[model samples]
Target: MTTTDLLNVRSLSFAYERRRIVDLWSERFDAGLVWLRGPNGVGKSTRLKLLAGALAPQYGSATLNGKVDLLTDPLAWRREVAWVSAEPPPFEHLSPAELFGFLAGLYPRADRARWELHIEGFGLAPFLRQPLRQLSTGTQHKAALAAALALGTTVLLLDEPLNALDEASLVHWRACMAQAAASPDRLMLVVSHEELGVTPTRELILKP
Candidate 1:
């Protein structure tokens, strides 16, 4: 991946309850798997959320391809970004199948075929009929991941992705990540305690 397809952040700062979480951080990440390595409470997930446009940073400017600015062109910027949270879905009624259908209608570039494949690849086909509350934590994460991966976005923010994956599902994800790492224009920031397999283009270690 080249610097032309970079995920660049400058003057990055964030605070919670008047306590500084991210303080004047600045980094340029080239397109590839970026291992977001840090100790717990270091704001790794918060940084991802900031980039995903879920949480606005107290200070900073971010750009994709040096063209799409997060602050100025947020709608266009969000089209190229996808976030996969480690936490299970908060809602209780919707199933993975229902979630996929809803997302397919929601996103303009939704890939229904890819979602079908992911459902089987993640071993979630059998649980498609089950409600979110009926599924296990791992299964819920799988559903969220499947939706995110199929969105065909350039920026993928994966928080603790390898957690709760079974042996076969883990293998599937490893292969998928390896393929993603080889992409020339895609950026993946994986927040994890363990390095699953693929090599990271860079390690972003955050300090509180």
Candidate 2:
């Protein structure tokens, strides 16, 4: 693995009842935008989950920053990585402001003003005071994206990031992703079948 690589997966494999889901054996990943593309049920999201330390690999191992085992230090590992999925978190009776506030507390140095700026940038300002459950799907997705960015983690794992976004919103998201990928210290991994406007530094195509 390169000294600058933030994540490394060696001989990594996982399966469900003898069916291999992810067989991405021996791959060294560095800091940049990596697009993991494959058809449905091909383990695209599963691989991202493993990288984010949200799921344990059935075989081989995953190492972060050369020393830390993601499974052993999930909390510490999560501090360095952020995962965003198509489905926004369930917010039943909680308002957007309340939900953002709760998530911000997880990061000791999270700036509330900065988070608000993102919300506004995403055109979520109008719904800030409304309950998250009542917001439209696109609005909810926007909120989730803002919350994930606010964490300021080094690694970002996004699954179907453009799910509910309109054409204009998709263009804006692509630009935002490009800007974020400009930082050499930060790595963004996207798992999507759709054509994202942003270009990836690396592309990993999964095969059955």
Candidate 3:
């Protein structure tokens, strides 16, 4: 493929209940925004999870930066990646401030100021100190988005990021995504059912 550092997946396969979801799939993800679009049950989320090293592949391998095998060097791969899932943070009892601090610890190089900036941009300041459970789904999603983006990782993975955003927030997040995509060194992988309001550099569409 292109002479760039790529997220390389080869002969990748996975299944649930003996039913195949992704079957011997292979692709290369390079820098800039790449939208993974597909209908429900097409394994878009599963592929994202596998790419983020959140789920172990049933077979085959995925490599990042040419040599970092996600299956073998998961922690190393994660160190350079940031993932935002469709679901909110699991620690509903934790406030956004606490959760952000925890994430900053994991990503020692995280930009806390940028995180706070996004928090404010997303109108999450009032909810920052509130427990995640007390925040609305959209607000909680904002918290996750802020933390993930603030990490400033090389690889950013998002699953259904636009699902719970308000119209204003959605526009703002789309701008943010565009800005992030402007960077040639950062790779953005997003799984969405609708247009993100920004053109993706590439797209991969799966099927049932």
- TM-score computed on alpha carbons, candidate 1: 0.92
Ranking under lDDT, best-scoring first?
3, 1, 2
> Could you give the candidate ranking by TM-score, starting with the highest?
3, 1, 2
For candidate 2, give the lDDT of residue 90: 59
Report how far off residue 128 is in candidate 2 (Å). Answer: 0.9
Give me the displacement of residue 148 in model 3, in angstroms: 0.4
The superposed Cα distance between candidate 3 and the true structure at residue 130, in angstroms, equals: 0.6
Model 3: per-residue lDDT, tens digit, 33-151?
Answer: 98898888899988878787777779998877787887788788888888888987777899988888888888867998999889878888888889999989999999999888898
Off by over 4 Å in 2: none
TM-score of each: 0.92, 0.89, 0.94
Q: Which stretches of candidate 3 lie over 4 Å from their true place?
A: none
lDDT of 3 at 95: 91
lDDT of 2 at 125: 80
Report the C-alpha lDDT of model 2 over 1-208, residue by residue, as the tens digit. 5364578778777787888887856777787788888777878887887777767788777677676667677777777787887567656477778877887777665667878777767888888888878989888888888787777777888999988887766766887778766767778888888887888888889876
